[model samples]
Target: MAPQLDTQTLGLVFQSRPDILAGIQQAADTPARTTLFNDIASFVYERLACADAPDGPASKRRRLDIAQPPAQTHRNGHAQDSVPPAGSQTGALGADAAVADPVLLEVKDISVTAPQRKKYDLCFTKNFLYARASGTSVPVQGIVYPWTDIEHAFYLPVPDKSQAQYNYVLLPRGSFLPTAKQASASAVDRQQPLEPLVFTVPATAPKPGSIGGSSAKTAEAVSDTYSSLFNWALTTSLRSAGNHSCQLVAADPKLFHSVARQPHRPNEKAVHVKAFRGSKDGFLFFLPTGILWAFKKPLLFLPLDRIVAVSYTNVLRTTFNMVVELDTEGSSDGSSTVEKEVEFGMIDQGDYQGIDDTYVRRHGLADRSMAEQRKAKRELVENAKKAPADGEGDASAAGGADGMTELERAQQEAEQRLQDEEDEMEEDYDPGSDGDSEGEGESSEDEDDDDDEDEEDEDEMGTAED
Candidate 1:
């Protein structure tokens, strides 16, 4: 007789699978990997736990949304004060007591939308730490006390059906804005993949209109189409806010502070960079891209001095080390050449320089295909169908109050978060992304907007904002 597997065991047995990892190899396969794996794990667990006997029929199971990341539960219970009676001592304290510093810890992970279907669900690796408890004084070792399990992945859930673009989800090669390299996918392509979660792809590539001197595809690119092409390509991928914000680089988190010194342009993308306020300095995370950020809109007036750190949550949701250094001398241009000398780029957790051909083959445009995609999508649906019959727990380990013991599984989720963020940060920084605020001076987003927009595009921006 076989030992029966329970939901816990089911989750445990297949805990190591990730979309990217599963595609790697079978020897690397874990339990509940395929519909078959989960089916087997489910059957085994059922046989063991069946109330009647080992011979009893197994019960039905359901698919769990592995993508749902554990909610952030701040370990430090900072006291929340209510609005006191007008002019009361309580009111004064609330106003003056240097409001409970909402510290920001930089995570190298970024979150981005897949361009279609998934909300900002990407993740990438970062060298930073997630403290079970808050405080920059001590180094973040690992999960502590109540947080026996550390969640490596996080998803920024965008409002369903909302017009806002949750630029944090990740789409495969032909996904959302699959670069010019990847086969460009359009909206009408219903075969277009949908994330396990719901999301929509941007309808078309934003066409930026005109610019005078440097040749880019300004709507009025005189006769220099090729030069315009080259410039447009860079502008579409690079952030103008001191190009340093999105390049691939590395640095010590403890050293840099304030986006001001680095002075991030509003519409710029963090790019291949993982940024976060180090655990040490208190930070103000300008997480205003979502509904909360749109409404609260704090970055505009928040005490700039109080912001000691900042980072990005891009499409893949990976955390990267974002080191923004401010120079009294000032950066010469917002382009990558000049920007890189400052904060630098986001280096991959793996051997970065060694990331040669092998790396490109794995992640580059070649990775996508119609047949491969169909096969992968079919398998996912199949697994989803059998999920309930198997009674499988979440193969993805999520640390909610539950006693989640699968650290390896948790790591898988974390990886997704990291990778997603990386891709998103970079895409957002594309010079022609048109992400900046309207006429608000030099911001990464604003610069990208100016680079890409034709006189006609400005009207679109206003409409899009609504």
Candidate 2:
């Protein structure tokens, strides 16, 4: 007797990919069948766990249809058809209202730095972190970061702002951005891509003497109280969620310090790079784990594991660009590897040596540009070895041309041949003059033939007289 597979899983596998299920069914042995079944089941589970495309009109209509029955059944209690009775509405909404998330940590008067600058009271709940408008207890309908989705947390310094820093959290790519359930429908409709959680503390503490300063001190104290708690909660959540890859990064000056110097804090070193991503000026922090670019919209964190190599480009006396090449997962069929690049430019040359020694060399991230040049040279040598002997003489003259790609040289040769043909046609073209000269030569030859004929006739007559 053979062990039976789960009927539900088998049915789902068959519905999703019949060929896969068929292969599982036609396995060579019992063990093979079990292995295939397990693999297919796992793949199907992961696929279903991923977020699906946005709900379509048909799905929305179906949901409306399903929701109408309960309301229609309770419509009799209502005096008007347009509005439902309070009891019915409360009953419909009570399911969600019954269980509220317990707040773990609450920080006040925090400001968002990226996407936009807005003041919000940051609340850390057991399952999520919500950013609500200041003095508002009600959760706003907007982006919420779930504890399980957060892959990393960083506490980094603000450039040129002494004793100022910000903390932000990053999510793994392809994860869905959670929305506050209590928020209104209008708020829910503003669905955007998963944005990084970017918030910064006030740069300066209020003076001790004023009333506003006292209030600011209170807010700062509240923020300080929960800062450590936030880190602990996030770490615990990551552990419980079995996300070993996730980390809580606190920038340590010992590992990799910023090359930029601060006159205010000459002894203290920051962990950041003053660089520009397009027109946006931002700071890059080289953490023990990876690099983080922040204080702007589209905040990016490149994990060390995902980074393939770091290469410098546009090298000059004043500034240069740094391009980070990232390794991406291949396609489902595993036919080819994928790569992605993020470039930050206008890095000061003054800070180059320190960064080169501390971050780039310490991490052993060799410059891929140099490697690529060497690879190109080796490829050229190999191509020369394989080149046919018939083009040996041309090859010497084509030394500079050999640097060009095969297609480019071929194109150049084609253009040159075309120009030569055009020049030959220009030299041969005598227009109507050549035609007139040929006509005169033909007339002279015809007159000469007539004279010869007359002479021959004269000779014949003389012979007859004799």
Candidate 3:
């Protein structure tokens, strides 16, 4: 089963990063994180474990079996099964949190200098859905000090009405602090900060490898690779000439961060995303290994507006693709209001090698060399029955003469397959065609005609008697 990292926890983790990492180091050095602070350590270690699990999930564990033919069962006249959105099973997470899975949060480009020197990645998921962070203010001595532990105040946005952006996120300072009470009501009560400090990753200069989606030059570059990668991942047999969706290529730590709404850590790039253009609610997901780009089918098209969550994982250390989801549904004034909707995730190797194959073919030198192996096996089996007592070049005998070799096994399988096809052909009973069932239907039609003739004769006799 896949490990479901609570995005709620991730959001908190994102807010408390640099400090959280610092705290973890301190705890490790002094064993400060005792029983009470285990959750923080759990979050960190589990992340490390996921990264180390190689040959585990994303290492092309099983050869893609979907490439096999689809089987049609006899009891399949009923419609195909559908996933019940209302009653679907989730890993016991909060409903609201699951639905808003950071679909558009980019670690916007890092800044390098003074007016632009501050470096911060803009991390947001969906605009309609808000990402929250609560800053905790722990009372250490006389004054209240912000714990900046992931449990700080919930970072809700303070709407800047004029600017259409929230000016500040309110902090309910009293909730987490210790309070005092007395019989005469003379004891002091702890109060949270009236105004919690609003720490914005100040809009600084874009860092060396960050990307910005606002600029035309930048948007084109970001989509150029990200879109291509997505398209290749969704590569299907329905591929037609000049009929292709804009492929999403993975970003390679360049101009992408400049515009990313969320900048991720060097360690946490083990996630990927898929957008189904045709889904009703709009998207579905697989863990890091579950999404294979080579498995292209209409079953995967996601609607642009319906993406609810993006849980990325670098299950293996080899994570690729830097990118964001863009909301291209432009607004009025003939100008775009929401210029860029960005979030970042990583794709693993099983997905990459598979995706890479299709791309190479498109550019011209792709090879699917297994056809020769299959052909040789077929010829070897055909010759095996005629070989001498001392088996020589028979494909099956060549494979292994030990009573049952792969070549002989394959021949048996092929014979059975042929027999099954013949049975299917014999079973073809066209209900309305010239079969026994159709003959029975024709007999009923003749009986109806005879009855009609008798009725006409009776009417004529009655008229003559009158």
The top-ranked prediction according to lDDT is 2
Expressed as tens digits, the lDDT of each residue in 52-118 for candidate 3 is 2333564222111110111111012121222123111121112222222332323343221211123
Prediction 2 TM-score vs. true? 0.50
Candidate 3 least-lDDT 10 residues: 66-75
Q: Where does candidate 2 clash, by residue pair?
A: none
Of models 1 and 2, which has the larger lDDT?
2
lDDT of each: 0.25, 0.54, 0.28
The C-alpha TM-scores of every prediction are 0.14, 0.50, 0.16
Name the top TM-score candidate. Answer: 2
Q: Give candidate 1 misplaced runs (Cα > 4 Å).
A: 1-210, 214-277, 280-466
Model 2: residues with Cα > 4 Å off, grouped in runs: 1-99, 175-193, 202-229, 236-244, 330-339, 372-466
Q: Answer with 1 or 3, whichever has the higher lDDT.
A: 3
Q: For residues 292-382, what per-residue lDDT tens digits would candidate 1 score against the true structure?
A: 1111111111112222222211111111232322221221211111211112123232212112122222222121212442222211111
